[model samples]
Target: MENIWEVSPLHRQVKSEGEMTDLYKIEIRDLARAFCGALFLALPLHYTMEMWARARAIPSFMLVVILVAAYLLNVGYCYYSNFKGRPARQVPWLDALESLGVGIVASTITLLLIDQVNAHMSFDVIMSCIALESVPTSFGASLAKSQLSAGNKEDDLTDGWATDKKKILACLLGGLMFAFNVGATAEPIVIATSINYGQLIGIVVFSLLVSYLMVFMTAFEKEKEDEGAVMGPQWAETLICYSVSLLASAALLFMFGYLTPTTPHNLAIPWVVVLGYATTLGGSAGRLII
Candidate 1:
C-alpha cells in the first residue's frame, strides 16, 4: 500500500522529500512577495505614496526599488542575527531602527511638503512628531518583539536565518501599518491655546491600540492569550523613555513660546513632541545597544 499525497495546512503534501522542498520554496517566494506588497500597500496615508505621486517617479519603478532594498535588508539583517544567538526581540540595528528610521524620515519629508505648500504647523509640530516618533515607534516595536518572541515556535529558536528575517519583516510591516493608519486618521492640526487635550487622548488611545495589534499580529500572534513573556526589554527601563519627553516638554514650553512661560500646562510641546520621542525611542535604543 502507498501513502496518499494530500496537502497539509503548511502546504507540503504528506509524502516525498522533493515535494516538501518544492513546497517550502514556493512558500518562501510567496511570503517574500506578500511582504513586499504589504510594505507598499500599508505605508501610512500621510507620507510616501501621497508625496511619491508628487515626485512622479512612476509607481512600478518605486516598487522595484522597494523590493530590491527590502530583500537585501532582510538578508543582511538575518546574517547578523545568526552570530548574535538571540531571538529578534533584541537585534539592535534593524528591528527598532527599521521602524524608527522610517517614521522620522517620513515625518521630515511630509513636514517639508507641508511647509512649502501648506505652512500650517510651527517648527514645534515636526519636532513634536519627531519626539513622539521615538516613543510611539519604540513602544510599537517593543510590543511586537515581546509579543512575537513569546509565541514563536521552540524549534526555530536557533534557526537564526529564518526567524530573524521574519521578525524584521514583522517590525517593518508594523511600522508601515502604523504610518498608514495614522496618516489617514491623523488631524495634523495646529493648536492656538494649548495642545488639544482631545487629540492627545486620541493619540494615546490609538498608539496603544496600534502597538498592541501590530505586536500581536506580526510577532506574537501565535502566543496564548494568558502567556507571560520573558523576552524583549525590561519594563523598568522605559522610565527614561518617558522622562526624556517630560523634561523636553518642560523645556520647550518655557523656551519655545509653546506655553505661557509662567503658568504650568498639562502637556508641553517638548514632552509630547520632542522629548517624548527621544525618551520613548531613546530608551529603546539604549536597550538595543546590547
Candidate 2:
C-alpha cells in the first residue's frame, strides 16, 4: 500500500500553487485596505494650509527624516497589524516598505486631485509636501488591519446589520454627532485664534488625557474579556484613536470652510486641537461601545 504520509510530486506542486494564489489574494486585500485606511486617516492633512506652507519651508534633511521615521513606524505597526489570521509568513520589513509605497502613492494622487501639486511648484517643494503627508498615510496603512477589521460578535451587536457595516456607521454617526454643529460654528476658530501657545499646548494635553480616560480608564462599557484582541497596549491605542479623532476634526472643519487655504497655520492647528477634543470623545466612546 502507498504510504499515507507521502505526497506525490504533482500533488505537492499543485498545493504550492494554491498557497501562492492564497498569498496573492491576501496581499491584494491588505493593499486595498491600506489604501482606504491611508485616505481615511490622512485626508484631513491634505486640506491643511499649515501642511502646505510648511512643505515649502521644510528642510530637505528633515523631509528625509520624516520618510525614514515613517518607515520605522510602519515596521513596528505592521509586525503586529498586518496579515492577521492568515497562513502567509510575516515579513514585517517588506510589509513596511509596501505601506510606505502606498503612502507615497496615496499622497501623490490626493495632492494632485486637490490641485496642490502644479507645474509651477518646484520639484523640491512637491516632493517635500508629499514626504510630509506620507508619514501619517504610511502609519495609517500599517494600522489598517487592526483599526479597520470587521468587528467580532463579542464587540458588535446581534442585530441584522452586518458587524463591519455597523462598526463603520457607528464611527460616522459618532463623529458627526460631536463635530457637525461644532464645525459649522465660529467657536472653534474663535477659541483657536484666541488661545496663546501655552493654552493651545494645554488643550492638547488635556484632550489626550480626557480621551484616554473616557475610553480606556473608565468602567463605562469596558470589556474585560477579549482585551487581548484589541490592538496595541492601552497608551498606544489611546494615541491612535486620538489621532483619528484629530483627523476627523480637521476634515470636518475643512468641509465646513472653517479651515481653508487662506487660513493661517497658527489658527488651523489650534482649531483642529479645539474641535478634536469633542471628536476625540465621540470617537473613543464610539469605539468603546462598539
Candidate 3:
C-alpha cells in the first residue's frame, strides 16, 4: 500500500492553492510521529550508564557497523512489514532512509536536551553516542505505521508467509520491550549471579523449553490454544521463534551495556544466554497478542 504519510498526486490535484499546505501538514504529522516513537524507545538507553560507556569505548569501525545494520533493518522492515500492501513503486526506498535519519535527529536532540552532550566531550564522542543510541530509536521510527496508527484498516492485515513474518516482527518487538525493561535494572543481578558454564547451559536449555511451552501449551485464550499448531512443524516453529528472541536478547544486552566488545566471549556468552530466557518468554507472550 502507498504510505499513508505520503501525499499522492490525487491529493495535490484537489484545488492547487491549498494543496501545498495540506501536504505540509501531512509531512509535519509524520515527523511528529517519528520523533515521538523514537523518543519512547530511546530515553531509557539515553540514561543508561553502560550505553554511555560503550558509546565512548566502541571503535569507529564498529560504530559504522551498527549504523549500517540499523539502516538495513529499518529498510527491510519498511519494505516487508510496514509498507506490505502498498504498491511497490509508492513505497520508496527514500522513506526508509528518511526514517533512519529521523531517528538519528531525534536521538541527537534528546541527548542534547538531557545534557548528555557537552563541551567537555569531543565531537567524535558526541556523534558516536548519538549514532549508537540511534539504532534502537531507528527501529522504533521504522515501526511508526504500527506504533502510531490507531485506526489501521482491516485490509492492512496479511496472510500466509506475510502473516508469519508479521508474527516474527511482533516477537522481536515484544522481546525488545521485555528485555529493555529488565535490562535497565538487571546488570547488578547479572553480576551477582555469575553462573558457571554448567549453570549457563541449564539456563539456555530452560529458556528454549519454556519458550516452546509458552507459545504452544499455555492457553492464553481457550479459542487460541491450538494456534501454535498452525504456525508450522512444531520443532521448526519453536526454533525460529526462539532464535529471534535470542538475537534480540543479545542485541538489547549489548545496547543496554550488559554485554560489551571488550568482554571475553566466555563471560558474554553466559550473560546473553541467561538473559535470553527472559526475552524468549517475552517473545512468546508477544506472539499470543498477534
Candidate 4:
C-alpha cells in the first residue's frame, strides 16, 4: 500500500548533500573572517621588537599557559557572540579550537614573513614566539563575531539595553586593542620622556574630551536612549571608562616592561598618558560598537 506521492531515496540523498555543501560554505566563510580579525589586531605586535624578545625570554611553561588561556577565552567568547554567524553548538569547543588554530596559523605565517623566525632559530624559541603572538590573534578572532559584523545596528532600540557593566568591559577590551600596539613599541616611552608637564596636562584634557565626543557626539540621534541607566548618566560612564583606559594602559605598559619600581612616577605617569590617548579613543569606539 505505498503512496504514489512518496519521495525517493535518491531525492533524500541529494537534499542531504546540498545541506552539507551549505554547511561547508559557512565554515569557509567563518574561517576567512577569523583570519582577517587575527591580522587586523595582531599584525603590529608581530612587527614589534618587544614581542620577539618576550618570546625568547618567557618560560616555556608560561607560553603553554598563555596558549591554553587564549583557547579558553575563545570558548567563552564564541559561546556568547556566535563567532560562526550561526547558532552556537551545544558545546563551543569546536569554535574555540578553530579560533585558536586561526590565531596560531596567522602568527606562524606573519612571524615567518617578517623574518622573526627562521631555520636558525631554536625550536623552543620558535614555538614560544608563535604561542605568545597567538594570544592577541585569538582574542581578535573572537571579537570578530561582534565588532566586524556587517549588520551592526545603530538604533537605540538595538543597543540601548546593554548594561553598564557590559559597556565598561567593552571599553576595557577596546582600550587593550588600541594600546597593545603602542605599549610594545619604544615610541610611547620616547614621547613621554620628551614631553613637559604642561604638555602632559594638555594631553590628558584632550584625551577626556576626545573620549566624550567619540561615545556621545559620534552616535546618531536615535542611538542616545538608555534603558539601562542604573549606573548614572552618560558623562559618568565616559569618565569611568576613561579612567579604566588609563589603568589598562599602565598595566599593559608594565606587562611590556616599560614600568618598574625603579622608574620614577614622573616618567611613568606621562608614559601612561601618552598611551591613554589611543586607549581612550579605543574605549569610546568600543562602547559605541558594543
- Flag clash pairs in model 3: 1-85, 1-86
**lDDT tens readout by residue for model 3, 138-182:** 766766666656523342333444556766876776676557556
Compute each candidate's TM-score over C-alphas: 0.30, 0.54, 0.73, 0.78
Task: Report lDDT (Cα) of residue 121, candidate 2.
Answer: 88
Best by lDDT: 4
Model 2, position 125: C-alpha lDDT score:
89
As a TM-score, model 4 comes out at 0.78
lDDT of 2 by residue, 205-243 (tens): 887898778766789854643333344566766676677
Backbone clashes in model 4: 0
Clashes of each: 13, 0, 2, 0
| Regions of candidate 4 where Cα sits further than 4 Å from its true position | 1-21, 57-82, 89-97, 145-149, 152-162, 220-222, 227-230
Where does model 1 exceed 4 Å of error? 1-19, 23-28, 31-151, 155-186, 189-235, 241-290
lDDT of 1 by residue, 1-290 (tens): 23121223445433332344444554344233323322243334334332322223223343334334443433333332311112422243444344444434544554465453235644544454333323232223223322223333332332444432333343333333233232222122133134565756554544334333433434534442322232334222223224333443343233223345455444344234422332233322222221
- What local distance difference test score does each model get? 0.35, 0.66, 0.67, 0.73
Model 2: pairs clashing at backbone N, Cα or C within 3 Å: none
Tell me the tens digit of each residue's lDDT in model 4 across 1-290. 23211333322322222453344455566778888888887888898888898778777876676677567756655544535654422136766888888989999999999899999999999998898888888877866756577633331222333677667767776777667777777888899899998999999999999887777776433466563565577678777888999998887776666787788988889999999999898888766664
TM match of model 1 to true structure: 0.30
Lowest lDDT 10-mer window, candidate 3?
83-92
Roughly what TM-score does model 2 have, to 2 decimal places?
0.54
> Sort by lDDT, best first: what order?
4, 3, 2, 1
